[model samples]
Target: MPIIDKEGNFLAVADNVETISNSAAIADVMAQFANAEILGIIFPTHHDGRGYSLTKKLRRAGFNGKLRAIGPLIPDQFSDLIACGFDEIEISDEQFLRQPLVQWLAAKEISQHSYQNNNSTKTSIFQSRRQKIAANRHLNLVRELP
Candidate 1:
């Protein structure tokens, strides 16, 4: 399995990662895994979205460690996964071969702007629209004053 950062950089896999299944309850393991240096959330399948929910819970619980999503996932989901708080994604060799590094990079580029805010650094469509509206309103007001 090859691990990739959100920026599409190939990352050296950490040997000391604490693994947890997506099905595990966050409340049950919060004390143990929350303080881990690195945590790996096992996603049995891309279709299983429990991992995303779990990640959110862990983050809210103050799990500030490196969070890794390990499973079979497509390049399309890269942005959503990052927004969901995954620091790195571990993909199978077959998926890597099929999608290639370029696809992952492209996905990262596309993630720069998104429709939903989701607490990510990327600017949301709503926020951009609001900024533009405010600028236009300011310009209109200035014209009226003159």
Candidate 2:
């Protein structure tokens, strides 16, 4: 995932995302949401309350991924974000890397529930494809391990 700084410049691209300390223009940032390889957003401190509103809009606009609060975000705001559809969080670099595993587990759990619920045929098909990819990767890892 790549992080963009406040000036709309590329900051870093890695398997994980880190804190974005710079303030970005919310409109421009949200425009990147559809095409950005970014897995999350990190709202910096000292800006207007645009970041929270941006995240809420992103979720409403169909961003089905992580939405993180980087600087000056208190724990009390977690539930609010969750209510708005923010999934994973990145409190630190370590937490960011670990988030993929958490997401994988969550996906697996949700897939199970979805199978039981029998709703959203499209989602079931997508989840089956995702599970197949995961299983294939696991088999590759196991093959490489020994």
Candidate 3:
């Protein structure tokens, strides 16, 4: 899951900061990449060194997932965040969504993955058709009642 702050700004909090320092904590999160589907990570502040370390570890570990900085990051920190593997950032929903730079960062380089031919698609189509009929009938009943 994408890590977000209280206001929904993305952030990457070092999982093992108290037990270990930034370097060690970053190593740990990197190691778990195989088992996790981390969409993005967030850094709390520019002053916090942990997030930068974490981003470096993720890149070294082959994590191509999105990285973002949240909280009290300064304008100067933006370049550093990109250097540390942050692809996109959440400044404001409107600005983040509308900005061309943000759009470019958000765009993924498509890769080929294995696909399974499941017959579930046909079953789902039939189920949806049935639901539509039922919904129409219910709507008619409600309208007739008045």
TM-score of each: 0.89, 0.39, 0.39
Cα error, residue 120 of model 2, in Å, equals 19
Query: Sort by TM-score, best first: what order?
Result: 1, 3, 2
Off by over 4 Å in 3: 1-39, 92-146
lDDT of 1 by residue, 1-146 (tens): 78888777987655778899998987876867768888999989889999998898888888888899999988888888889989889988888989888898887776587788775678889999999999999999999994
lDDT of each: 0.86, 0.47, 0.47
| TM-score of candidate 1 relative to the true fold | 0.89
The candidate scoring highest on lDDT is 1
User: For model 1, where is the 10-residue window of minimal lDDT?
Assistant: 6-15
lDDT of 1 at 113: 71
Candidate 2 pairs with clashing backbones? none
Clashes of 2: 0
Instruction: Give the candidate number with the greatest TM-score.
Output: 1
**Residue 141 error, candidate 3, Å:** 90
For candidate 2, lDDT tens digit of each residue in 1-146?
32323222333444554233234555655566554444455566424466656666665666554555554343344334444444443344454354433443344334333332121223455577789999999999999995
Residue 89 in model 2: shift from native, Å? Answer: 2.4
Candidate 1 whole-model C-alpha lDDT, 0 to 1: 0.86
